[model samples]
Target: MSTVSRAPKRSLASRLPVVHQLQQSVGLQRGMLIAGLVVSGVFVLTAIFAPLIAPFGFAQRRDDAGIFGAQQPPSAEHLFGTTVGGYDVLSRVLWGAQTALFVIVVSVILSIFAGVLLGLVSGYFGGWLDRVLVVVCDAIYAFPSLLLAIVMSIVISGGQSSLVGGVFAAAISITVVFIPQYFRVIRAETVRIKAEAYVESAKVIGASSNRIMFRHVLRNATRTLPLIVTLNSSEAILTLAGLGFLGFGIEPTAAAEWGYDLNRALSDVTSGIWWTALYPGLAIVLVVLGITLVGESLNDLADPRLRGRRAVAQSAGVVAETSVVPGGSLTAGPGGLGGLEDGESFDEHGIETR
Candidate 1:
């Protein structure tokens, strides 16, 4: 009896559009996705294993005499060479991975929570609150993202060398820039979904506003955020670097950061000390590229129309393959039948003649 009662519920749930979307999410642009995953995975692993992988501590000097020479070219002792400040360029680059990871994680998480919350409220309520919030978001969005980040960094830390302060400054600045984006996405989705038939049904059935917003609308609205987060993560790395380069970033000797490292290397390039600048710059480029690729692939995946097209293509291929047997027999199975009966055709799954 219970099994009988549950079957219809399962069928209804399976038929939901959301279910179809989830089913189609996989194997879209497989090559791009695989490449993104591989590159992003390398950065994540490098950040996680920085301590074990780095040959020397980020600030460790080569000798006990505390007089290590600067600008030493790549050699057996120093693989990538030494910075003008006598720090190992390789070690600093490796440790910088940790800093980059922290900033991305902290900033993205904060932005998502704040932006989603505001977006949900403004979108669902749709009153003065919504109007006011929208205006504010638009105003904030007008500023250049990098410029906004710099201002936020200065306001937060005054450009001091405290690692904690620097991290917070970078993260919070990024959050400010991204919150409006998230808000706009979720708000628009909420507005559309709040009027959805299912939402109306939930309301008619005495479901509370909170329940409808959080339970039904939130999930659908956030489907695009993974893509946004991925793209924003790459942007965050660039912002952090920009801050470091402008002297508003992590302080000298406080921690290893690519931007700060690059700032130190600006004068070296003129004198032919390439290793100091090359490694950190390369790190930024590679990481941003990896993240951008993942985001773009994810954007493609999140589009239901694209997924639906793929599904249709697959279904068409299946039909083409199944209907035309190699021996030119129209049998449902091998040696079963010669042709379909007059005015008969197979159903979509090739079952149940009609």
Candidate 2:
């Protein structure tokens, strides 16, 4: 029997190029990853334990000095101070955390479900269904998101202005605005990935269109989805805040909404009680900024071109030289392996000749 020569085994480091590339990306540093995790953890924990974490029940109010001391600067007694309604501002703010988290979670869930479903259908079908969704999405997109939300709020409940009504209105409006973005992004990705070898192979194997589109195609196509979802949640929060600021969001009488609270304090800016508006507004900004930073870092990690620059730089450090062999021929080896002579094999062992 003839001897068999085995091919060299690849090292684990060389097997997963995408992972290596991701590690080399900007903002994929250990510090950024830790910061992102911390932000996400805090937001999630605040949402989950809002009742236990808050100093007072969101809707509960007492007829004590706390309510009378409206606009007191942050102190040991009141962390965020009191509002004009003899309500504890700190309590309201803490309670508002629940509201903000609720809105974000609800709106994002709705948006992602509707958006991804519509996107997959529009992309995969690409006919009258696509046209219909595109037109509807475009119409909603044409109206400014905040304005559309305000109009929707007014239309849905005949101007009820209740917390539940406002939340539902905001959810619907935000979902509509974001659906088009998701549809477009997913569609573009689908269009490219449908032509890939794996997709084509799946089709050839008699897999159903829905299976191929959802299980095979979408899984590969949604590498950017985490970042998209993060950014959209941030946008939803800002839109909700803007509606509250404009007097179209949660009702003023409701427990404590950051937006509604900010609206109440608008007139007091001229007075020395800047803390009322300032603290809530700052809360909105900080939350938005935190989400934005995490989203940007994820984007960097997902983008291959951005991630591979460091790998390319490292590759440039090592070099191999080549030279011509004897008898007017060329070959490649470390410091030059000579060209094969006549029928001789390139290996130095000469086992083939033997």
Q: For each predicted model, how many residue pairs clash, with residues at least 3 apart or on different chains? A: 0, 1
TM-score of 1: 0.82
Clashing pairs in 1: none
* lDDT values for all models: 0.86, 0.72
Tens-digit lDDT track of model 1 for 1-354: 354444334566666643433455556466666677788899999999999999888888766656457899998878999998999889999999999999999999999999999999999999999999999999999989989988898898874668888888889998999999999999999998898899999999999989999999999898788778999999999999998898888865777899999999999999988999999999999999988887887677677677577778888878776746467635553223543434455565666564
lDDT of 2 by residue, 1-354 (tens): 999999998668866633343355543453565565577667667767777877766555564544445566777776777666556676677677677787887878887778877888788778998889888887877878888777776676567656777677766767767887887788778878888998889888899998998898888767777788889888988888887888778774654578788888987787878778877887777777777776777677667776676767666653222325556436543323442333355356434441
**TM-score for predicted model 2 compared with the true structure:** 0.76
Model 2 has an lDDT value of: 0.72
